[model samples]
Target: MNWNDLERLFSPARLGRYSAARAGDTTKAALDYTYNLQLSEAMMPMLNVLEIALRNGIHTRLSALYGREDWWETWVADTNFNWQNKEVAYAKAKLNRRHEPQTPDKIIAELTFGFWSSLFNTQFQHVLWKDLRLVFTRCPKHQRKRHNISSALNQIRDLRNRVFHHEPLLWLTPTLIQQHSVGVMVINWLEPDLAVWLNTQDRLPTKWAEWNITSD
Candidate 1:
C-alpha cells in the first residue's frame, strides 16, 4: 500500500525514521523498513552459528582448564573473576525456577550473550582472560588482545540487541556491515572451518551490496 497503510501497520513512530530520512517520502520509508526487516531475518543464521560456536568454544576451554566437565560448579569459589559470579548465579537460579536441571550445558545455554561477551572486557583480563582467551583457536597470534576482541563483540552484541528488539537497522547499515564483519571475524577466530561454512548461509552482505541502502 502507501505511507498511511505502512504507518498503521507498523505504527508511525516505528516508521518515522524512514519517513523523516526520505523527505516525508512515506513510500520509501515503508520500503526501507521492509528492507531492514528482510536484512534482519537474513542475519539470524550467522548470528545463531556465532553464538553457539562462542559458547561451546568457551565451555570446552573452561572445562579443560579446570580439569572437569562441570567446572562452573566451583567457578566462583575457585576463580579470581568474582565479577561474573552473580551472572552465573542468575543463570542457575532461572533454570531452577523453570524446574530444569542445573546441568553445565543447560546453565551455559541460559547464560546471556552479555555474560559471554563480558568475559573479554578488560576488567576480567587479569583473571578470566588468562585461561579463557585460549579458546580463540584460530585467532591470529599477534592480534588476539582482549581489547580488540572485546570491542568487536560489544559492537556485535549491540547489533544483536537492536535486531532482537525490532529496532531499525537501515540508519545503521554502514556501521552494521562492520559490526557483522567483526562478528564473523570472531567466529573465524574460534573456528576457521566453521566460519568458512558460515559464509555459505549468510545473505545480508550480498543483499547490502545490491540495495546499497546507505546511499538512499
Candidate 2:
C-alpha cells in the first residue's frame, strides 16, 4: 500500500491522541517497528507472568476445592457458579476430538487467557473471596481483596489485547508500568519462587533504558 493507504489502515487516531500528534512526521514502518519492539520488550513479559499466575492460582484453588487436578469438569458442572460455559464446552470438544486422552493439566494449559481472566468477573465473586483466597495467600494481608486482584487482571488483560492487536503503547508507558507491577504482584502472591525467577527473566527495564523514545 502507498503511504496514505498504510496510514489509513493503521490510523494514528485509533492509537490515541498522543500518537496523532506525531503522525505527520512518523512513517508507518517506524511505527510498526516501535510497536513490535515495545510488545516484545515491555508487554510480553508482563503478559507471560500474568497468564502463568492466573492459571496456576486458579488451578491450585480448584484442585484444593475438588481434591483433584481434574476439578475443571466438576467446577464447570456446578450450575450455581456463573462461569462462561462456552469456554468449558470448547475445552470439552477439544478433548473429545483429540486422538489421545487429555489430562486436566493439559486442558488447563490449553485454555485461553480470556477464560482465566473471566473467573475474576463479579459473577464469580463467591469463588474468588471464599474458595480462592488462599491461592493469593502471599499477597499483602491488607491488599488481598478480590476486587483489587480483579482490577489488576482487568487492566493487564486490556494491555494484552492492545499489544496483541498492534495498537499503540508508547503513549501508555505509565499505565503499562503499573500493569507490569500488578502482574509481578500477582505472580509473587501465587508463587514466590516463580516471582523471583520472573524478576531475572524480565527485560523490560533494560529495553526501556535503551529506547530513548522521542517525538518524531
Candidate 3:
C-alpha cells in the first residue's frame, strides 16, 4: 500500500543509493547488499502465493461455470499436484514432480510463464474473448477487451519472473501496484457469478472487501 514499500521492492537499488549516500560508513555498501538480498528472497514465496491464488481463482471461476466439483478438487488436491508427471498437461495441469520435490530455478521460470499462457499452444485469446462476450455483448474495442483481467494476469506473471530470478523487489511503484490491482479487477469481474455459486454452497466470504490483490 505504501509507495515507499514499492520503491523498496521493484527498485531497491535506488533506495540503496539513498541509504549509502546518507550513511558515509563503508559498511553501508554491505548493508545495501544485505537488504537487497533479503528483499529478493522474500519476493519468492510472496510471488508464489499470488500465483497459487491466481490458479485457484481461475479454477473457481471455471468450476462455477461448469459445476464440476470433482474437477475442482482434483486440480487442488495435494496428492495430484505433480508439475512433471507425463499425465499432466495444459494451463490447469498439475505441477511437475520436480517442482514439488524441489523447486528449481528453471521450474520457477516455467511456472511463471505456463500459468498465464496455454501449455499446448491453444489460443487462450478465445477464452478471454468468450468471457468478454458474455459480460458485454457489444462495446468499443477498448471496453470489449478483458483489460483488467488481462492486465492483472500479466502483472502476476511478470512479478513471478522478477521474484524467481532473484531480482530486487522491496519498494513497489504505483504502476506495480496497479498491476496487482488487475487481479482484483478479474476477481471483481467474476464476483456476481462467484457469489451465486458460493450461495448455493453457503460459503460466501464475509469480508470480501477486505481482500486486496496482493502476492501475500
Candidate 4:
C-alpha cells in the first residue's frame, strides 16, 4: 500500500517521521519502519544483558558495603541517600501493592534502569563511588574512575530507552553502534566471559553492518 493507506492504518502520528524521512516514498518509508523493528529486535539482547548485569553489580556491591542484602531499608532511612528516597519508597509501595515480599532480589528487579544509572551521578561519588566502583573487576585501574563508568552507564541507559520505545535508530548507524558498545564494554568490565556470551546472543553487530551497507 501507499503512504496514504499505510499512514491511515498505522496513524499519521506514528508514520510521519518515516514518511518525511523518505520524502513521501511509500516503499522507502515502509522499508525504514521495517528496519527500525529489526534493529530494535536485535538490540533487546544487548540491552537486557546490560541492565541485568549493571543492576546485579550494584546490588552485590551495595549489599556488601552496608552489610545487608536488604540495604534499601538502610539507605532509605539514612539522610545521606535522600536523592533516592522516593524511588526506594516507590519500590516498597509497589511491592506492598503486589503482595510480593520486599526482598533484596525483588527490590533490585523492581527498580527502574534510571534508578540504577543514577547511582553513578557525580553527587554520590564521594559516598558511593569508592565502593560501588569496585563492581568493574576487569576494568583497568586507571580507567575505573567514577566519571568514566558513569558516562558509559548514561549512554547505555539512553540507548536502552530509545530502543525499548521503538524509536528509529538507522539514521546514525555508526554512532548508534558506538553508543551500544558502551553497554558491551561495561559488561566486559564486569565479567569477560559473560561479555563473550552476550556477543553470542547479540545480532546487532551483524544486522547493523548489513543494513548500514545497503541503507541508502
Candidate 5:
C-alpha cells in the first residue's frame, strides 16, 4: 500500500496506547516519542530538497535518463503526497553560485544530492546508501529487505501522510534515526567534491578521508 494507506491504518492516539503498553518506563517512553519527532524533522530536509530540485528543473537529467514520464508531475499535484515547502522555491533559485540558470533535470539531481550534503553526517550518509541500494539493486516489492532510505523517507512520509489523512501516528519507530552509509557513497558519486564540502560542514567523521571522494 502507499504511505497514505499506512497512516490511516495507525492513529496517534492508538500509537500512544501502543507505546504505553510497550514502553518500560517514563524515560523510555519519552525517549521513544522524542526520537520519532526528531526522525520526522530530519526527513523533511530531503523532501524539501527534492521538491526544490524538481521545481527548479534541476532533476531533468536523471528523470530524462530514467524515462520518467509523470513521476514528477504526479508528485507536484499530488494531494495525498504533498512534498512542497516554500523554501524549495527559494532553494532552487539560489542553487547556482551566482543564480546562473540551470535545466530542470540537472537542478533536481544537484539539489536532491546537494541536500544530502547539508544533512547531519550520521543520517545523511545512511540515507544516501539506502537510496543507492534501492536504485542499484533489483528487488521485488514482495521481498524488500531492510531498505534504509525508504525506511527513513517512508517513516517521515508516512508520518506526514498520516497527519494529512486525519489519522494518528501509531506505527512510528524510535530506534530508526541512524544513518546507513548510503548518503556518504551517494554524495561521493553525485558530487565528487562533496567530500571536501562535507569536511567544511564539519558533519562528516574524520575517517571520511578514507573514502577518497574528490571535491573537484
Candidate 6:
C-alpha cells in the first residue's frame, strides 16, 4: 500500500493526532521504524521471561502433581478433559514433527504460549488450578486472587500477538507498560533470582526514555 494508505491503517486515534498528522513525514518509513523499535525493545525481555517462566513453572507443578515430567502425555491421554484435547493434540503433533523424542521439556518448549495460558481457563480451572497455583507462589500474595494470573497472561498474550504480528503499538503505550510490569511481577513470582537478573537486563525504561513517551 501507499504511504497515505499505510498511515491511515496504522496511525489510529490512539497514537494521538501528532502521529497521524506526521504520517506523511519521511514517507512513513521513519514512523514505522520507530514503532517497531519501540514495541520490540519493550516486549522482548518480557517475552523471553514469560515463555521460560511459564514453561518451567507449569512443568514443575505438573511433574510434581502427576509424578512425572511427562505428565502432559498422560494428561492428554485422558478423554475426560476434552477441553484441552485440541491443544494437547497440537503439542503432540509439534513434537512428532520435530522427530525428537517427546520429553517433557521438549513438549513444554513446543507448546504455544496460548496452550500454557489456557490452563487458567474456567473449563480447566477446577482441575488444574489446585496444582498450578502452587507454582505461581507470588500471584496470590500480590493479586490475592487466583484468577488475576489468567487475566494477566491473557493480556500479555494479546500484546505479544500484536507485537509479533507487526501491528501498531504506539497507541498502546500505557497498556504496554502495565503489561510489562505484569510480566516482571510474574517472572519474579516464578523465580526471584532470575527476576533480579532480568531487572539488570531490562531495556524498557531506557527505551521509553529514549522515545520520550510521557507517562501521563
Which predicted model would earn the best TM-score? 4
Candidate 3 lDDT score at position 142: 62
lDDT of 3 at 158: 70
* Predicted candidate 2 versus true structure: per-residue lDDT over 1-216, tens digit per residue: 455554477674553343355565446445544655665556676678769777887888888887998776666667754355667667767887885367777778777788877777777786656877787888888998778878877777887788788665655756555656777878888878888887787877555545435333
Q: What is the lDDT of candidate 3?
A: 0.43
Q: How close is candidate 3 to the true structure, as a TM-score?
A: 0.41
lDDT assessment of candidate 1: 0.81
What candidate 5 gets wrong by more than 4 Å, as runs, is 1-14, 17-24, 46-180, 195-216
Model 2 TM-score relative to the real fold: 0.79
lDDT of each: 0.81, 0.70, 0.43, 0.85, 0.39, 0.72
Ranking by TM-score: 4, 1, 6, 2, 3, 5
Q: Could you tell me every candidate's TM-score relative to the true structure?
A: 0.89, 0.79, 0.41, 0.92, 0.32, 0.80
> At residue 90, what lDDT does model 2 achieve?
77
Q: What does the lDDT come to for candidate 6? A: 0.72
Q: Assess candidate 6 and give its TM-score to the true structure.
A: 0.80
- State which candidate, 3 or 6, has the greater TM-score: 6
- Report the C-alpha lDDT of model 5 over 1-216, residue by residue, as the tens digit: 432333357544544543564553444444444444444444444334333432333233334534663334434554432333222455456776656665555444444332422222343344333443343233344534344334444444444454344332324344122231333333343344543455454422322232112211
The alpha-carbon lDDT assigned to residue 108 of candidate 3 equals: 33
Off by over 4 Å in 6: 1-29, 77-80, 140-142, 213-216
Q: Can you write out model 6's per-residue Cα lDDT over 129-156, one digit (the tens) per residue? A: 8888887776556573557878878888
* Candidate 4 C-alpha lDDT tens digits along 1-216: 766787788899989888798788778789888878898999899889888988999888999998988877777667777768788788889999999998878888888988998889988888899989889989988999999998888878888888888787877544778877877888899989999998889998888887777666
What's model 5's overall lDDT?
Answer: 0.39
The TM-score that candidate 1 achieves is 0.89
User: How would you encode candidate 1's per-residue C-alpha lDDT over 65-167 as one tens digit per residue?
Assistant: 7788777666667555565788889998999899999888898999888888987887778767878778886899898889988887888888899999988
